[model samples]
Target: MSGLPAYSLPCQSERATLVSALLLLLSWLATPALAQDLGTNGPTYAIAEPHLLRDLQHRLQAKQASGELDTLMARSRERAIASVRDPQPIEGVAATRTPRTFYYDPTFTLDRNVLDAQGQLLFAAGTRLNPLDVVSLSSHLLFFDGRDSRQRDQARRLIAHYEGRVKPILVAGAYLDLMQAWRRPVYFDQHGRLTRQFGVTQVPALVSQDGARLRIDELETTQ
Candidate 1:
């Protein structure tokens, strides 16, 4: 009060408040411009609609007219037959046997339930499955790269050998349509689940249950 200019404390507080209000107003005014810039810079996307039936019919007609379908079917049949013939004993590079004692936990709550194709309840929610409850449902899986003719042939032979005795699954193969054309009732591993679960890194590998353990055998194609 003695040396400084005479200023009211309330007046200074009002000035500070006014400055803060102005800054807030300026920030609010800039928000719309910032949003417009982002909108202009962002990517745009469009939905795609495909005519599957029309395309399939066109392809079928073209193949039928060109006589390629018959040729493909014949080649596929020959390959299927070749796979089963001249069964060469698999030459093993290594054999691994591991215990298959894995347990399954219910991932869903009681409110969630599993249904069948006909909307029938397959399993109620909160249903837990033990290791013994799923032992009989285990399947023998066959792993192969499918690009190699030798491996395909070996896989086919193995399928033929275990026909009716085991369910054969194809891993890392060519198109499923091509396999179906061969008239083999084999299933393809679309997601690489079996390969990843079993740590299979080699082609022409066979996985079968040995007592309470899984026996994984990696085989080589003989020249």
Candidate 2:
């Protein structure tokens, strides 16, 4: 009150705090720089290792010089050919050891609106439909393992019995070789898609249209 005008005087506590902060700031500014450089505790050396890309390139060069790269490439090419010629057999699907017959209803409900090329809604969402109503299975599907002679023979017999109305579909083994041998378009069920769709879990299975539903007959054959 005595030092400052009554209107200019703020609270004593706030004024003291402000003065203290200014003093602390001045003290800090008056103090010398305190940054210390504690040198490395252990020995240090320049990086001797090559860059990752350079190292990889060197290793690749070494492999190429040894003809290892060529071998790896050839092996990769063989694997690729093998995969296309004979894809990995579907797991849990074995040669028909147990005879079983089942039916699959091809009816499905639309989860979303199906549109035509013009973006016009062809079928609204939640609509139930059967594919058989529009187009029936043109040929009966004969699913079997081409690797087994018995199954191949069975497929051939079935194809002949069906009067060449059967489409030989392979669950495993070389499809191209079978196609050439059978002189027809031998289809391979890539990843057992058709089998899973039809609920077929075994080989030597015959799939035929039984009206609106598909009849799957998993037959047992001798070794």
Candidate 1 lDDT by residue in tens digits, 69-104:
556556656877755532222233122233233322
Q: What is the C-alpha lDDT of each candidate?
A: 0.56, 0.82
Query: Over the stretch 171-193, how does candidate 2's per-residue lDDT look in tens digits?
Result: 88999998898789998888778
lDDT of 1 at 23: 44
- Cα deviation at 169, candidate 2, in Å, is 1.3
The stretch of ten residues in a row with the least summed lDDT in candidate 1 is 86-95
Clashing pairs in 1: none
**Model 2 bad stretches (over 4 Å):** 1-49, 117-119
